[model samples]
Target chain A: GAGVSQSPRYKVAKRGQDVALRCDPISGHVSLFWYQQALGQGPEFLTYFQNEAQLDKSGLPSDRFFAERPEGSVSTLKIQRTQQEDSAVYLCASSLSFTGGPLEQYFGPGTRLTVT
Target chain B: QQPVQSPQAVILREGEDAVINCSSSKALYSVHWYRQKHGEAPVFLMILLKGGEQKGHDKISASFNEKKQQSSLYLTASQLSCSGTYFCGTEMDSSYKLIFGSGTRLLVRP
Candidate 1:
């Protein structure tokens, strides 16, 4: 119960439709990350949030993909005009420190999005 | 760029040993290892920093060679629970964004 939690374990979206996925990081985590995983490939970075500030978003595939960590604890990833290429497993991870040591981030079960 | 992982998949018997290597073209600041089972989230396995301070569970060891810009994960005495796809996340920038490689599927047979 103390680990990261993601809502809507699965989602189905139509072309040109929009969908929002939510992620709740571990309590007191300072760093949050969003990643997209294809069927058999490893997760690819999408965006990152250090507290409420989104430090890096260069990994975002396109402007249609938007993510925000409003209060720095809960984050949401919204995809506008969903495309078949957007179909993938969305993962959320959180870490306590960024300086070093136990730098590992905890990941949620992830939401599998199917854009048909 | 995403790091390259070797031996796309491997089969091991329980109690056997295995090593997973992650190599990056660019200088690596750190390497994070994780394992993901079918239909599950990736669980953190270990973290190796550039300087030192390698964090991992018992029977699992990792080393980060800053000069080589790579990391190696050593799995000592494999177990059934160790059966999963292993991923190596490489950090080149200070922003904490990790570029993960195509996972290596590892099956530990009992």
Candidate 2:
């Protein structure tokens, strides 16, 4: 089976631009997650989805960041009016279960977004 | 809150051993360990549940202490392939979200 995958492996956007990153999770995965990793730092949680419902999104830095997973399979993270501080590697992960217990998550290669 | 990892970085020689620790301020339900090489996605290493079970494979192992809200990752007989940034993700009780540590950079030389 294929692991989690993200599109637009690299993107360069000018300040104030809007960019959408796509994530294709593993087949039959019930949980999807988005994270942001700054240079030399660990990944920080951004949002999580269970099926088609967004279960948690408190980690989003601001209103400019939005995410959706309408069909419970593929998900998208949109950043409106990108700022220089938004430049980072965006990672997507998926898990087979949503039991609120400890489950292994497989990660994607990530999308490196540079807001210049 | 995000967990704090000790010894921001460590250098090791092949066949040596090293330990990385993560401490969280909040009550934790589980802890996860991962290693990420440059220009690559993070690879999962191990997960330690609240019961204080120690899990491992190969030369890597981890221990979780529920009472202290802390976890430790042990890498024994290190190899050059173990060089990478190690991160510990802590999950609070019923939160289902993982808050990661700053990371511990490990360098192994032959």
Candidate 3:
């Protein structure tokens, strides 16, 4: 794809169920980020990855949330034992800068996760 | 900490102007601006890295004040296409992750 792409644009999961969202960043991009956005709010950072290294996960709300980029191109966000509060749009963004410097990020369509 | 944005919502007519502000409590390394419409992902508008630097494309522009840890987005001669939710993402000097503001909703009526 010419830009960032996410799979399963919409996912509905029952409480206590688990879900995984995938993100495929633009080719050759080195930095990927995951964010959660609630209704009428801005995106909150969840995690950050530089290439294949998971450098920062401080924004993750709890231990149940996990993310990985095994190949440095594609990334996945997994939430275990989902709760109602987990319902939100999960956004994926990628930047070409590898130094963790300032750069414009390209965002995906985002996967809307609905937990009931 | 999350940045704070003013004017939760605004309505503007064609050719009008609007300004959205984002303020943070901590020192920042950079500030980024993005716009997201209903059911769509955020589109990057511009990024300000240095203090007192102003940049713009077309009728939209932005300014960053590193000392006060604030940034403002300017929309001049607004068009219907400019109607959307605007967000400011802030990055601290010690981290690479972006902490975004609550957002400013702008409506442009023609």
Please give, for every candidate in the order listed, the TM-score of chain B alone compared with the true chain B.
Answer: 0.94, 0.97, 0.96
Q: Write the per-residue lDDT of candidate 1 for residues A1-116, one digit (tens) a residue.
A: 59999999999999999999999999999999999999999999889899999998988999999999988799999999999999999999999977654478899999999999
DockQ of each: 0.75, 0.78, 0.81
Instruction: Please report, in order, the local distance difference test score of every candidate based on alpha carbons.
Output: 0.90, 0.94, 0.93
What is candidate 3's CA lDDT for residue B33? 96
Per-residue C-alpha lDDT of model 3 across residues A1-116, encoded as one tens digit per residue: 59999989999999999999999999999899999999999999999999999998988999999999998889999999999999999999999886746888999999999999
- Model 2 pairs whose backbones collide: none
DockQ of 1: 0.75
The model with the greatest lDDT is 2
DockQ category of candidate 3: high
lDDT of 2 by residue, B1-110 (tens): 88999889999989999999999988888999999999899999988989889998999999998888899999999999999999999988756688889999999999
The residue ranges of model 1 lying beyond 4 angstroms of the native Cα positions read A99-102, B52-56
Ranking by TM-score: 2, 3, 1
DockQ score for candidate 2 = 0.78
**Alpha carbon deviation, residue B1, candidate 3 (Å):** 1.3
